[model samples]
Target: MEAELRDPIAAIGLDVEAVDLSVAGKRRMLRVAVDQDGGVTLDDVADATREVSRVLDESDVMGEQPYTLEVTSRGVDRPLTMPRHWRRNADRLVKITLVEGGEFSGRILTSTETTATLDVEGAEREVAHADVAKALVQIEFNRKRSLPEAEETEEDDA
Candidate 1:
């Protein structure tokens, strides 16, 4: 069931966050969560669900039984605790805790196979990707702040 959903999502250039299969009463339910670069839209979710359902119908991989299929996006409150999750959310602010018990708050600059670069206080620091004990998206204060008139004038001068 997982491979059935993953293959179509990958072919469509979407990321499959999770695939869950559960049996309810006599019916099997397949839930797939998908995401992409900015985010997943309602249309995108519907399209993916339709495509996956078509594939499943054609393949009859679920056997000769009735099942329900649902596809959706990951919720906003989802945690950025996994390396691939962090990598996908690059350039976003994050609070990272190291395995050695230290914590750093910074923007995720980049990530490689073994390391992640963080822009901390104007200085770029590289930490082992595995060393990130926990990482969560940081709330942005600027989103709530209005720019002062003076700041706007300075921008006009530039």
Candidate 2:
């Protein structure tokens, strides 16, 4: 389904991030996660839904099975499993758990197909893809840029 829907989804400027098929009672649920460079919007999801439904309806792929199709954006809590995922998350803070039962958090500095360089408290560490069991980006909100403003405010108050 992914291969068949790739071209159609790409036509709408969306990329198929993942396809999940599960059994919901007697019916099947087909969840398709779509994403793009910046992000996916409601319009994008709507377009992808229509395109996927049309393609599936016109094809014999579903084989008369009635399934609920859900199109959604990539969730922030989604695990980072691929190099492209790491690349897209560059400069973002992430918590990684190793297959060997070790865990660490750092900001992603650079990434390649096999390794990622992270800034771990002013120190750099390189991690290999094979060593990571799970990785999730940490959400940062209203983070200020540097301490210059705070320092200047203190000087004025004095």
Compared with the true structure, all predictions reach lDDT values of: 0.81, 0.91
TM-score of each: 0.69, 0.79
- Which candidate has the highest TM-score of all? 2
The digit string of per-residue lDDT tens for model 2 on 1-158 reads: 78999999999888889998899688999999988877778999999999999999999988887889999998888998988788888889999999999899999999999999999999999999889999999999976656688898998899
- Kindly list the per-residue Cα lDDT of model 1 for residues 40-108, writing each as its tens digit: 888899889888888888897789888888898876456665566767778888888888898989888
Off by over 4 Å in 2: 145-158
Going through the candidates in order, what is the number of backbone clashes in each? 0, 0
- Which candidate gets the maximum lDDT versus the true structure? 2
What number of backbone clashes does candidate 1 have, counting pairs of residues 3 or more apart or in separate chains? 0
Model 1 misplacement above 4 A:
22-29, 59-67, 81-84, 141-158
State the displacement of the C-alpha of residue 136, model 2, in Å, after optimal TM-score superposition: 1.2
